[model samples]
Target: MFAGAVRVGTIDRVGIALSGLCVVHCLTSAIMLAVLASAGGILVDHRIHAIGLVLAIVLGMVALGRGIVEHGFMMPAAIGGLGLGVMAGALTLPHDSGEVVYTIVGVAILALGHDLNRRAVV
Candidate 1:
């Protein structure tokens, strides 16, 4: 997909633009999830955790909106919703299990986001 030139229409151009924003936040969430795991707990830095939590919420909402706008459904919301579940699970884990779970879920979010962005309509 990265090998060819991007021939973008106006709507596609807008989608392509938004693709970056949501995906970018997804990436940021991944990184923050990693660091938040180390220092024993994310509560240690509520600010960073707060940022990731907010980003995850935003990405989930945007993905949901895109699915509704583009396809009259909520597939993006579903995918991002899974990410939200994972993130919440990670945050709530009693111990370091959060790190392990977050990593696995983060990878899924990254892959799902990529697939959603890559697929041609229908």
Candidate 2:
């Protein structure tokens, strides 16, 4: 039981870290694109965004699902699901301000869900 709890905690931490990275990536990419067009263009690759989205989805589902099962809390998982949906929707939109807005908002909400899950587990 203790070992499983530790594992879940680790997964939750990792999910939170990934969400943080997503936020940083979004903010930095936006700033860089606006400030240094050429350099920022190189930094903001579609592959990176896609990878981050995939990681966020996988990790969020795993960690949040575990939390819900263990704690019997639905809100965290629901919020995270909503956030994931928003982020996925962003992928289909134009790569302009709209996409950035959606990504940032989704990451924020997803991070909140992870935080809530951590608190509930504890």
Candidate 3:
């Protein structure tokens, strides 16, 4: 049981880190798009967002699923699910529109969910 808890904690941390990376990628890509438009092809790639969202979904679900089992709480999973939904919604928007804002907000919420899950585990 201790080992499983530790693994869950580790997964939560990874989820947080991934969320931070997603935020950084969104912000950096926006800045890069504004400054050096040539870099937009790589930085603003839609595939990157898709891949990141997939990762976020997987990590969030696994970590939060374990958290609910161990901690017997639903907030973390609910928050994380909301975040994932927001992220998925962002994908429907045009890249040049409010996508970045939605992505950042979703990532931040997801990171918060991860932090909450970690705290509950501890």
In model 2, the runs with Cα more than 4 Å from the true position are: 1-8
RMSD to native for every prediction?
8.1, 2.1, 1.8
lDDT of each: 0.50, 0.83, 0.86
- Per-residue lDDT for 1-122 in model 2, tens only? 33365665677778778878888888888899999999889767888788888988888878888888888899999998999999888888876788899998898888888888888885
Q: Which prediction has the highest lDDT against the true structure?
A: 3
Q: Model 1, 50: alpha-carbon shift in Å?
A: 2.7
For model 2 the local lDDT of residue 13 reads 77
- Which pairs clash inside model 3? none
**What is candidate 3's lDDT per residue for 39-119, written digit by digit as tens?**
966988888889888988988878898889889889989998989999999999999749999988888888888889899
Candidate 1, lDDT over the whole model = 0.50
- Deviating ranges (above 4 Å) for candidate 1: 1-44, 95-97, 110-114, 117-122
Angstrom error at residue 74, model 1: 2.3
Pull out the clashing pairs in model 2: none
* Superposition error at 89 for model 1 (Å): 1.8
Best TM-score goes to which candidate?
Answer: 3
